[model samples]
Target: MTHAELVFVPILGRGHIVSMVEMAKLLVGRDPRLSVTVLIMKLPFDSDFDSYTSSLAASVDTARIRFVHLTCENTDAEISSASFLTNFIEGSKPHVKRAVAELVDSAGSTRRLAGFVLDAFCSTLIDLANEFGVPSYVFFTSSAAFLGLMLHLQSLQDEHHVNIAEFKDSAGELDFPSFTNLLPTKILPSIVLTKESVRSFLEHAKRMRETKGIIVNTFDELEPHAVRSLAGLGAPAVYPVGPILSLDGETKKKADGSCGGDDIMEWLEKQPPSSVVFLCFGSRGSFGEEQVKEMACALERSGHRFLWSLRQPPPQKGQIEVPHDYADPTEVLPEGFLHRTAGLGKVIGWAPQTAILAHPAIGGFVSHCGWNSTLESIWFGMPVATWPLYAEQQFNAFQLVVELGLATEIKMDYRRDFRMESGVMTADVIEGGIRKLMEEAGGERRKKVKEASEKSRKALMEGGSSYLSLGRLIEDILNNMPLT
Candidate 1:
């Protein structure tokens, strides 16, 4: 293979696309002959990914990566159901098919399509890869534990005739396979309980089994059991190449084309090491006014140095997504809250999460337990107080709190009743949760996470498990590549 090329197709979400691109950068950095081509999906409005991807690509002078946008006819309709997770990939199949055909047809005599790397959402395209006589791999931007649970859930639904929706009206312990945690009905992924999600997830589950191979953005040390189960699925291969994140303080740049957090960094430097608690939900997370007020009261009662990245509740009409810049906190939060906590706290529209989590002054994280945030906290050896909002976050939180024992739960049943998903958590609960996470005796969590962090770093170095596994995956794909 002279100039091996891989096609990466990522869905229309910030976390998903960013992880895929960063993985591309890593593959290019490690392999001299490899190159990656990313296919981006265009939306009705200017997307956050548009500026972020273009900016990041410009800084990398290696010429090893190229991005192409796949334009579709019904972008608005596609985005309308973006919460369905795989809807864009479903709606844009025609566009993706056309783009792949063009690329395959137009490549010169010397260049060859090495393989296809698809996001979990792009699983439906595996057949297209077969049509072109190339292998297709599904890249999961989540933890191995969650992946295992989803696979098990599919088996339960298919074989045992388990009705996942029954958990919605009733609450009890779940009989999940390969998952040691005693999962409550309240803590499943938001998708598992929704009627619409049933179809999307089932189709995705089936496609997952049909791929040539799979890769996960997690390490072996983090979830030995789950990763082991995934390998036992007997795929072409299951490669674990992660903590595959930028630990060097590279925040996902804002869509406006700026790093945008010098002031936050300067403030962090002023605080003592491990003194501040950083609170921020993931991109789509937002809270109702009641929850905001409760959080304000909790911060006051806890009397801890804090940095909160707050946003307004989701718009009444549409899906949950991050606003570029939200309005002032005084308007939405309780009166006098900002002023009372002025010297003791820092509140920003959007906190540079990757930078802040890597900071020395950050002792704890008050997170929505998004997998990216969860993995980042793990990489930096930070303890977490989990508050899951939506999607698969509840499941991630369960893993952190119960399975991994790396975090404390703020509210486990917050999303059990979807109608009360944004309901308030009392100031008492919030205060106690923060105190439990930040002021725990003996620092056992910090010690455990630090040890795990060390193991994760070593896994990416020479002769490490993750590094060796990735080498095997590359060799398998190259050896199996069809002759042009």
Candidate 2:
């Protein structure tokens, strides 16, 4: 029997890399005849995935799933615009081409080239796939709803000549086929309002149409309307094979062990069931001292048990802004705030989010509305108070609050870039949102999230929606294998 290998090119970010790798694992695990070769593109700055990749390589079967790290020249140039990602990926074209050629030559007739699974940011690599005479599929790391919005916005620009930048100033709601409710302009991703970023996203959306299919990291049940709308659109076939999370916690567990793992779990164990609220932004989420003070005041006033992951914004290395643990969180936090909320609140530098959410004590989450965090919150049946900061997080927050009614709103339009000018969320607003999350809307949101959690798990089981979709995707890959 001839073996087949699908080449996966994932973005360098932790969330994207982990999710795509999990998808690759699922594919190879489901079919013994198939294998996956993930082309790891290292970012110019330190992304700190060395341990993760090393651990994963050791744990997985290398024969079936292997990681090929691509070498690119390092640049110390500062990345101030959104085009950096596009430019970096474009620059790696020659490296990608060389890697693919080497893989083809090494396989000879023993294994056939199946196809290319491109990350959302790497859509430009589709042309490379075309040159290699293999089908290309996009592994979109965000929600299906966001995917629909991207395509819709692209069409609006291409066909209708509608300017998305105008939405920044307009106080109007736009209707998109992907969502059931009217979307307010305020909730549009901050990137869409900027010329360069919008151009980059639109270009990605345009090229994504050239792929054989677009695989979204979402399940049908979670975003039914968005998933259904994609089918009617004229774009390529869409496969919703997800909630694809790295549930094993291998990478995080290692990090957690070094960072007072016992202390966090021990504190949680002491709290009463469903009483403590967890306030964690995504990995990149952090705030200025002004905002941090307000959050501390709010958590104190709310009189609820809490776990806050307060991180300091690391100095800009390149384009990416990673948040690091503060040497002393009290430096940024309010005076005597830690002492005041000592028993009720535990403010830590880094948190084991999934582990915390899984604990019985976690009642609700104050989250950044990042797709991975959103899915994890749902998986653990935790109601969320959306506090989106950057990227597509504002839109994700809106989808959860207004479109799906699964999350309560903290501040849907808050963006990191415009944080100072956007005005600090007052202590009262923060307190009210936390109260609403843990008390008022908690029951209904918990019920819905619990239901979604159950369906999400079932979706991966045999005979489930995601299972069938993955099977279909694999069949497509097998059928598209090049003849030797």
Candidate 3:
């Protein structure tokens, strides 16, 4: 057999790295002749992914899937700036170049160097891949809808010269090729309105056109319109091979036992089937005292069984926010709230989200609309109440609530931008949203999610859309292999 090697370059965050690794795993598992080399980059002040990566390394076959940590040099640039990720990835080009050179040298003729898989944020590295005479593929970690939106917005700026900043407060709806429904300007992601952030995003979108293909972390059944729209865009060929998730929950258990995996499972087992509403934000999701209090008030008034993952914001501001567990839940929550809703609700920090969503007792999800969380909810057939915070989440909320009708909207425009002060969402609004979500638990929305869940699973089976896409991707890699 002619061995082939593909190099994967993922961004520094946990979400991006994990998803990229899962994709690599799927690739190697599908073909014995292929192997993957993941080049890991570390952010200066972020939480370490050592334990998680170490655990994964031990469990998997080391020969097929290898992780190489690059030596990243610190820069004087401001860590909290919007362009931090881009700048960091750009600076690490030398390390990436050296790693790829070493891999090619060691492989010789027995294993041919196939291609480079770049993260969405790491598009600048495409130049380096070109330097080494290898094809590059982008691994987009968000929805295909979001990818289409990025390309659309890039066209708007490049061809039409439209200033997106002018639409900061516009109350109008705009049509995009990816979405079936018109998107309201109010629900646009907070990042797009900012000059610096949008510039970075558009730059990436433009560079994405130069890649061999873009692999999105979504299934075609879940976003048929978006996937089809992307195919017609004349950019790069898109491969929708996903619902790629870390479902085992072992990493979270090993990383932090205090995340309460066993305890949460025990509590869920005691509850009636399809009765508890699970409220968990993504890894970086957290809120202020006032917002936390209102959430408690709404949960108490709704009279529904609930599991809330409440995390406290970092002690200082103007830096990267790393939310931690509150010493006492009552400090941030309403006074006597825990005692009042003792049997009905359980508030813990750092929940095992995948496990919780998979449980039979979980009826609905109040999520931040992160792509991974959205896919997990769909995979488990849970109805969602969209409550987005930061990044592309606001746009995701709009897609879920207005476009797909798969989720009830808590607030499509709510954001927690560090640069500005967003108003606290009041208790009545949250209570109303919660009431609507629980009422539709067994209704049309639930039916749609269940059907999507089935399709999502089948998409990965042997003759499914994702399975075929992966095969095509592997063939493309082999065809692009550099001649000896």
Candidate 4:
């Protein structure tokens, strides 16, 4: 048997890292002769490597799959001031250059460096792979439609129609014939929407052209137009392997060394099927005090069962607080809200999102529209109440709610590139959408969304478009790529 070694480097973020891990697990399981290494970022707050290292060890033999830590203090004031973490994979070329060199040395001579798979924003990895004469795969870490929208951003700029300074201003729709005029700069990826951040986005686009192979975590049938559009871009090959969840298909979160055991599923199981709404606003999106209060009021008003993932408290001096009259659903939530809504709701700090979404009882998702969360919602065949929080979330929301007819957007316009700081979707709006999605009165909405859910399931099943893509990706791209 031929032996090969592959390295997976992910931009440091919860969602991106998780996706990389899933792909890694799938690859190792498919090819016994292949050895894999995962390079994980060492954040200051996380002083030990046990948590990440042990998870991989549990999945694969320690000898075949290993974890290496890249010790970088991401807290450098300059890096933080420049928002490097948010833009790390795209703009921080210098840092990535050094990091890659260090990794190459650590990898040693035993295995030839095989083709590399990295987050889409990690365009610098393309250069690193070229330097080593290795092929590279770029994971877009977003919807295929969103990737198509980003690829067209440069064209939008070249046309001189996107006014970066005034993108936040009420500019009437710009023409995008390729997109059915569905995407507006205001609704494009958040990176493209900001005047201050345009340079980083341009750099990212320029670097993306270097990818030899591209992977999007989406099925072909889900966004056929976007998939075809991506093919038109210079990418030699594009693969859609999605609903790329890392969790086992099982509904419970069994404790696997070093990872915490949370009982979110146990709580979810008690609820009636199609009776509860699961709400989560990814890791980075946050709501101010006012928005939080509004959501509490709306959730209360809707009189529907809910499980809300509260935002971590803001770092500002004046912290946001829940309404005085609101009931606390858990000790983790602020004071009174739990006691008031004990029978009707539960608020957890962070639930096993994928497991919860896959639960039999979850009827709908109230999401921040982060790409990973959006896909998981669809994977579980649940309809969505789209509430965009940051970056490309608004763009994802536009596709899911308007173009795909799978969800209802809480608002039409987001606060201009204030990014996630624009605040949460208004509570009254949230209440209305939730009511329409969760109750019997939501009949028409349910029927339409249920159709989308069916399509999503069909896309991933046997003989499904995504299943074929995964086969091709493994057999054609991953299996054939030369390993050093």
Best by lDDT: 3
Q: Between the candidate structures 2 and 4, which one is better when assessed by lDDT?
A: 2
- C-alpha lDDT score of every prediction, in listed order: 0.78, 0.84, 0.86, 0.66
Candidate 2's C-alpha runs over 4 A off are 59-62, 75-77, 250-260, 316-319, 418-421
- Which 10 consecutive positions of candidate 4 have the poorest summed lDDT? 317-326
lDDT, model 2, position 281: 87
| Cα RMSD (angstroms) for every candidate in the order listed | 2.5, 2.1, 1.7, 4.8
Model 3 regions lying over 4 Å from their true place: 251-259, 419-421
The residue-by-residue lDDT of candidate 1 on 242-272, one tens digit each, is 8777545554455586666877899999998
Once superposed on the true structure, which residue ranges of model 1 sit more than 4 Å away at CA? 72-87, 232-236, 248-259, 416-422
Looking at model 1, which ten-residue stretch has the lowest summed lDDT?
Answer: 75-84
Better of 3 and 4 by lDDT: 3
Compared to the true structure, candidate 3 yields what TM-score?
0.96
Per-residue lDDT of model 2, residues 1-484, tens digit only: 6788889999887778878888888888899889889998887665566765777677675478888989864544345556677778887888899999999999866788888999988999999898989999999999998999999999998889988877888899999989999999888887788865787888889999999999999999999989989865556989999888877653245444564556789899999998998999877788878999999999999999999999887675223556888889889888998888887889987787888889999888999998989888878878899998878899999999988878999889887753213668899999999999888643776788889889889988899999999999989988888876
Better of 1 and 4 by TM-score: 1
lDDT of 4 by residue, 382-483 (tens): 788877755677878888877777787666445422343454566678799888778743566567666666776776677877777767776765555665
Could you tell me which residue pairs clash in candidate 1? none
Residue 406 Cα positional deviation in candidate 4, in Å, after optimal superposition: 0.7
Top candidate by TM-score? 3
| TM-score of every candidate relative to the true structure | 0.93, 0.95, 0.96, 0.83
lDDT of 4 at 320: 21
Higher-ranked by TM-score: 2 or 4: 2
